[model samples]
Target: MAGIGFELRKMMRRDTLTGVAKAYLYAGVISSGPLILSIIGMLLIGVLSLGKVIPDFLITQFQVSVTYLIAASLILTGFVQLAFTRFMSDRLFEKRIDLVLPNFNAVVLIATSMSGVIGLVLAFTLFADLSLGYRVLMITGFVILSNIWIAAIVLSSVKEYKHILGTFFIGYTVTVGAALELNRFGLEGLLLGFVIGHFVLLIGLSGLIYRNYPSDRFVSFEVFDKRFAYPSLIFVGFFYNLGVWLDKFMFWFGPGTGQQIIGPLRASAIYDIPVFISYLCVMPGMAAFLVRIEADFVEFYDEFYDAVRSGATLAHIQESRDMMVRTVRAGLYEIMKIQAVVILLIFAFGDWLLDKLGISTLYSPLLRIDVIAASLQVLFLGALNVFFYLDQRKTVFSLSFVFVLLNGVLTALTLHFGPGTYGYGFAGALLLTVIASVYLLDRKFEGLEYETYMLQKS
Candidate 1:
C-alpha cells in the first residue's frame, strides 16, 4: 500500500480535478478490486446457474463451499499475512531487496503446504459424503486461494496498479465464464471452474512478483529466524482476522440461527446476505482510506520520523509530529465522512435494493445496521494503519484481542436476545475498539518525542 501511495502521490501532483479523480479511482480499484470482483463473480455464477443447474440446493451448496473456503483460508493464513508483510518492510528498509523475493517464496511454500494438508484432511474426512471430484476440487481451490493471498501481499508492493487490476479482472472473468460453461455438470463442475480461475490468478500474481522482484536464490527460510520475526504481529494478524469473522461465525453456527448447508458448514440466511451486501459498500470507504492514509497521512508520518532520525531541532520535530497528528485526524475524518454518505444512500434505498435483488425487504433493517458496522470496520482499519506506522504492535494486538472478545460475547448475547438485536454486537465491538484506538493514538502522539528518545536500544 505504501508502494501504491507513491504512485498515487505522483498522480495527485498534477493538481487538477481529473488528476485527483484518477488517483482515487486507481486507489479504490487497486485496494478493493479483487474483493468486489470475487463477490460479483460468485453472485453472477449463482444467478447464471439458476436454471441450468438442477435442484436449487446445489447452487446453495456451491456458494457455501466457496464461502467456507475463503473464510477458512483467510483465517488460517492470517498468522503469516501481516507478519510476512512486516518482514518484507524491514528487509526493504535495510536495502536487502534480494531477500524479499526469496523469503516471500519461503512463506508461500510454508503457507501453501500447511493449507494443503489441512484442506486435504478436511476434504477427505469431513466431506466424505460428497463426490470425490467435489472434494478434490474443494481442496485444490483452497490451496490455490491460500497461495493467492500470500502472493497478493507481495503484489501490493508493486507500483503497476493497472497490471494488478487486469490480472484480477481476467481471472474472475474466466471464473464466471468457465463456471457458466461447466454448470451442466453441477456443483463439482462449478468448484472446478473456481479452482481453475484462482489457479490462473495465483500464477499471474506470482509472475508479477517475479518480474518486479528478481532474486538470485529461489527460496529462503530466513524469515523464520528469531531476529526477524515479530510474535506480536503474528498474533495481531491472527486475532484481527479472527475478530473480523467471529461474529459471522457465531451467526453461522449458533443454535437455531443457521442450518447445515453441507457436511460441517452452516450458514445463516438471516445474516449472511446482508453482511455480504454491506461488505460491497466498503469500496468507497476503502478508496478514501488508501488515498487519505497512504498518501496523505504517511507523508507526514515519514517526515516526523525523518526529523527525529536526523536530529532536527526540537521545535522542528515537534512541528512534524503535530503535522502527523493532524493528518491522522483528518484522514480518519475523511474516511468517516465518505462512508457516512455511502451508508446514508444505502439507508435511503436499501429496501428497494433488496427488492431488486429478489431478497425479502425484511432484510432492510439488518442491511442498514450491517452497513454501519462495515463503516466502523473501515475506521478500525484506518486506526490500525496509523498504529502500525507508529510501530505500536502491542496496541494493535490488544485492540484485536479485545475486538474478538467483545464480538464473541456480545454476538452471543444478541443471539440469546433474538432477531431484533442481531448485527448490533459486531457494530458495538468496532465502535468501542475505534474509540479506544483513537484515544491511544492521541496519547502516543502527545509523548511522541519522549518515546522516540527514551525508548531507543541505547
Candidate 2:
C-alpha cells in the first residue's frame, strides 16, 4: 500500500484543488471500492428484484445467506491471512519475488480446500430444507468468496489500483445484472448470480497476480515452515476478525433480539441494518489512513530504519526516531479529524438518509452510534497498521485478544440490559481498544531507541 501511496502522493504534488481531491478520491476507491461495490451490488439486487421476484422473502433469504457467507468465510480464512501476508512480505524483502506467486497459489489451494469442505457440510446439513440447487450455489459462493479474500490480500500489494478497481466494478456489475435476470428462478437464481460474480472476481485477481509475479513453480508450502510462519500472527488475525464480527454474531443468535431467517441461520434486522449502513461511512477514514500512514508516516519510518541499519550516529538515529514519532502522531490525528467530520455528517442527516433508503427512522439513533463505532474501527485499524509496520506482533496479539474478549462480554451485557443500550457495547469496546492501542504505541515509541540498539542479532 505504501507503494501505491507514493503514487498518490505524487498526484497531490500537483498543488491544485482538483489534484488533491482526485488523490483522496482515488485512495478511497482503491482502499474501499471492492467492499463498497459488494454492498451496493447486493442492495441493488434486493431493490431491483422487489417486483420481479416472487415471494419477497426470497430476497431477504438471499441477503441473509450472502451475509453469513461473507462473515463466516472471513473468520474462517483469518487463520492464514496475516501469517501468509507476513510470509510474502518477508520473501519480497529478501528479493525472492519468484517465491510469491507459488506460495500464493499454495495458500489459495489450502484455503479453497478447507472452505470447500466446511461450506459443503454446512450447506448440505444445515440447509436440508432448501432446494438442492440453492444448497449447491450457497456452498459455491462461499468457496469463491473465501478465495476472493485471499486474492484481495495479494492484490493489495500490487500497484495497479486501476485494474483492481476495474475488476471489482465489472464483477459487481455482472452480479447486479445477472441477479436481476436470475430472480425469476427464485433464491437459487440469486445465489447463482452471486457465485458467478465472485468467480469472475477470483479469476481476474488471479490473472493479475500471475501477470505481475510469474513463477516457475505452481505451488509451494514453504510458507507453512515453522521458521517462516508466525503463530502469533495467526492468533492476531483470528482474534481481530472474530472481534469485528463477534458482536454481530451475538446479536444474531441472542434469544429475543434475533429471529430465524433460513434453516438454522438467524438475523437481527435492528442491529444489522445500522451496522452495515455505518460501514459505508468508513471510506473517508480509510482514505485518510492510507494517505497519512502509508505515504506520510512510512517516509519517516523508512528513514529511521535506514539510519539504524547504516550505523548512523546515535544522535542521528534518535533524530530520525523522533521524526517518525511525530509523523505517527500527526497521521493519527489527521485520521481522527477526517473521521470526526464524517461522524458529524452522519449525525446531521442520518434520519434523512435512513428514510431515503426506506428504512425506518426508528433506527436513526443506532445508526449514529454505529457510525461512531465504525469510525473508531478505522482508527483502530490505523493503529494496528503502525504496529504491523513496526513488527510489534506480541503487542498486536494482545490488543486483538482484548478486543475479542471485551466485545463478547460487553455485547452480552447489552443483551442482558435492554434495547436502549443496543449499539453501545460495540462502540464502547472499540473505544477502549483504541485507547489501549494508543497508549501501547506511545510506550513502544518511548523505548524504541533502546529496543533497537539492545535487542539485536549482533
Candidate 3:
C-alpha cells in the first residue's frame, strides 16, 4: 500500500488542482478498490431483484444466502489468513522467497479441506429444506469464496494495485452477467453463477501469484510446521475478523430486528442497507489512511528506528523521534479530517440519497449513525496499522478482543433497549476502541527511546 501511495504521490508531482483531484481519486480507488467492487456486485444483485423475470422474494433469498456465505467463510478462514500472512512475511524478511509459494499452497490446501468439510455439513443440515442442487452449489460457493479470500490477502500483500483491481473487475463482471442470465433457474442458478465467477477470480489471483513467485512444487504442508507458525496470530486473526462481524450477526439474529430470509438463514433489511452504505462512504478515509499511515508515518518510523540502530547522536535520535511522533499525529489528524468531511457530506444529503436509492427517509438517522461508526472504524484501522508497524501484536490482540466483547454485549443491550437505540452500540464500541488505541499509541511513542535502546531484544 505504501508503494501504491508513493506511486500516487509521484503522479501528483505537479500539485495542480486537477492533479490533486486525480491523486485523491486514484488513492480512493487503490484503497477501496476490492471493496468497491464487492459493494457494486451486491448492489447489482439488489438491482436485479427488482426485475420482473425472477421472483423478487427468491432474489432476496439469494442475496441473503450469498451474504451469509461471505460472512461465514471470512470468519472461518480468519485464523489461517493472519497466520499465513505472518509466516510469509517473516519468510520474506529473511529473504527466503522460495518458501512463500510452497507455504501458500499449504495454506490454500488446508483452508479448502477445512472449509469444504464444514460447508458441506452446514449445507446438508441447515439448508436441508432447499433443493439438493442449491445446497451443493451453496457449499461449493462457500469453499471457493473462502479460498479466494485467502489468496486475495496474500495477493494484496505482493501484487501491484492495478493488477488486483483488474482481476476483481473481470471476475465480478462475469458474476453479474452470469447471475442475470441464470436468474430463470432461481436461487440455484444464481448460486451457480456466483461459484463460477469466484472460481474465475481465484484462478486469476493464483496465476498472478505464480507469475510473481513461481514454484515447481505443487503443494506443501509447511504452514503446519511450528517453526514458522504463530499461535497468537491465529487467535488474533480469528478474534479480529469475528469482532468485525459480531454486531452485524447480533442484528441479524435478534428476534425484533431479524427475519428468516431463507431456510435457516436471516437478514435485517433495516440494519443492513444503512451499514453497507456507511461502509461505502468511508472510502475517502481509507484512501487517506493508506497515504498517511502507510506512507508518511512509515517514512518517519523507519528513519527514527534507523537512527537508533546507527547509534546516532542523542540529538539526532531525538529529532527523528520527534519527527516520527509528529508524523503519526499528523497522519491520524488527516484521516479524521477526511472522514469528517465524508460524514458531513452524507449528513447533508442523507434523505435525498436514501430517496435515490429507493429507501425510506425513516432510515436517515440510522444511516447517519452508521456513517459515523464507519468513520471511527477507519480511524481504528489506522491505529491498528501503526500498531502493526511497531510490532505490537499483543496490544493489537487485546484491542481486537475488546472490540469483539464490547460489540457483542453492547449490541445486545441496544436490541434490548428498543428500535430507537439501534446502531448506537456499534458506534459506541468503535468510539471506545479508538480512544483506547490512541492512549496506548501515545504511551508507546512516549517510551520509544527506552523501548528501542534499553529493552533487551525479545
Candidate 4:
C-alpha cells in the first residue's frame, strides 16, 4: 500500500506533457458534465420548446443579446485577462504564495462587483423597451454565468492544476445532475446550477490550493507591479488577438464591410456561422493545453537556453535542437490532427447542423481558409509558448503586425470594392503570413510571440 501511494504521488508530481495529458483527461471528464450538458440543454430548449412558445424573432434577439454581452465582456477584459494569468502564475512560480491570496481575493471581489454592475445594466436594457422579458432574463443568466466562468479560467492557469481538475469534476457533476432535476426553474435553474457549481468548485479548489500551497511567506509589492516584463505583453497580445479576428470584426461591426456583394451574393452571410462554430471546437484544445503550456515553459527555461549558452559542442547543440524540433513537431502534429478531425466533422455535418437550426446560410469556401487559420493558431501558439522564454518578443510583434497589416489592407479593399469577399480578408492576411514565415524560416528560424509567455523560473 505504501508503494502504491508513493507511485501515485510521483505520478501526480509530474506535470509534463504526458502528465498534462493525464490531468486533462480527468478535467475533461468533469468539464464534460457541464460543457456537454450546456450544449444539450440549449438544444433541448430550442427543440423541446419547438419554436411555438418562443417565436424565431425572440430567439434571434436572445442570441444577439447573449452574443453581444459575451463579446463585450471578453473585449472589455481583454488586456486584464491576459495579464491576470501571468501575474498570478509569476507569483506562484517565484514561491511567493502570500501574494496569491491577496491577488485572488482582490480578483474575486472585483469580478463579482463587475458582474453586479453588468447585471444591473442588462436589467435596464431588457426592461427598458423589450417585450421578450423571459428570453431576456434567460440570456442575462448566461452573461452572469460567464463572469463566474472567468474565475474558473484564471484559476486553472495557476500551478497544481491536476488536483484542481479533480475537485472541479466532482462539483461540475453535481451541477449537471441538479440542473436537470430542477427543470421547473427554467433558465434560472441553469444559472442557479452554475452558481452552485462555482461555489463548490471555488471552495473545493481553493481548499486544495491552500493545503498544497500555503501562503505563509510575505511577498514583495514588486511582485504585484502591473508593469513587469510579461505584464506589458497583454497590450501587444490584445492587439494581436484582435488582429487575428480583425477580419471577422470588420465583417460584423465595420461600417459598409458587410455591404460587399459579388453580383447578388453577400459574403458576410455565408462566412459568419461556420467560422463561429469552428471556434467552439477550439475550446477543448484550449482547456487541455493551458496548463501544458506553462509546464513546457518551465522545461524550456531549464533546458533550451541554458544549454545553448553553455558553450557546448556542435554535437550537443544539435542534440538539443533535435529535442526542440521534436517537441514543436509533436505539439503541432497533435493539434493539426485534432483540428483536421474537427474541420472534417464541421465540413461534413455542417449542412445538417446549420439547416436544422435555420442557419443554413453560413457555409462558404471560406470554411477551408478559416480551418487553416484556426489550426495554425493552436499549433503556433503552442510552439511560441516554449520559445517566448528565450526573450523572443520582437519577432512575434513583427509577424503579428504583418498579419494585421495584410488583413487590414485586404479587408478594407474588399469592403470598398463592393465585392463579395469576407474570408478574403483573412485569406489575404494569413496567406501573407504563410509566405513571409516560409521565407523567414529559410533564412533563420524561431518566430515571434505577441504574448509575454514566461511567468517565472522555478
Q: Which ten residues in a row have the lowest lDDT in candidate 2?
A: 29-38
Candidate 4 lDDT tens digits, 420-447:
5656667667656755654543233332
TM-score per candidate, chains pooled: 0.98, 0.98, 0.94, 0.66
Comparison by lDDT, 1 against 3, better one: 1
Which candidate leads in TM-score?
Answer: 1
Against the reference, the lDDT scores of all candidates come to: 0.89, 0.88, 0.82, 0.52
- Cα deviation at 110, candidate 3, in Å, is 1.1
Count clashing residue pairs per candidate: 0, 0, 0, 3
Ranking by TM-score: 1, 2, 3, 4
lDDT of 2 by residue, 1-458 (tens): 36577777788789899988878887887778555667778888999999888889989999999988888888988999999999988887788989999999999999989988997888768788877888888788878888888888887778787787788878888888888888899988898888888888889989999998898999999999988979999989889989999999999999988999989889998899999889889998889888888877888898999999998999999999999999889888988999899899988988899999999999998999999999999899999999999999999999999999999999999999988999999999999999999999999999998888898776
**TM-score preference between candidates 2 and 4, better one:** 2
Q: What overall lDDT, based on C-alpha atoms, would model 3 receive against the true structure? A: 0.82
lDDT of 1 by residue, 114-230 (tens): 998998888778788878898888888888888888888887778888898889988998899888899989998888888888888888999899998888999999999998889
For candidate 3, the 10 contiguous residues with the lowest summed lDDT are: 1-10
Where is model 3 more than 4 Å wrong at Cα?
A: 1-23, 33-36
**Model 2: clashing residue pairs?**
none
Candidate 2's TM-score: 0.98
| Candidate 3 per-residue lDDT over residues 78-191, each given as its tens digit | 889777877776776687777778888888888889888997888778877778898888888888888888877676455366786788778898888887778788777777
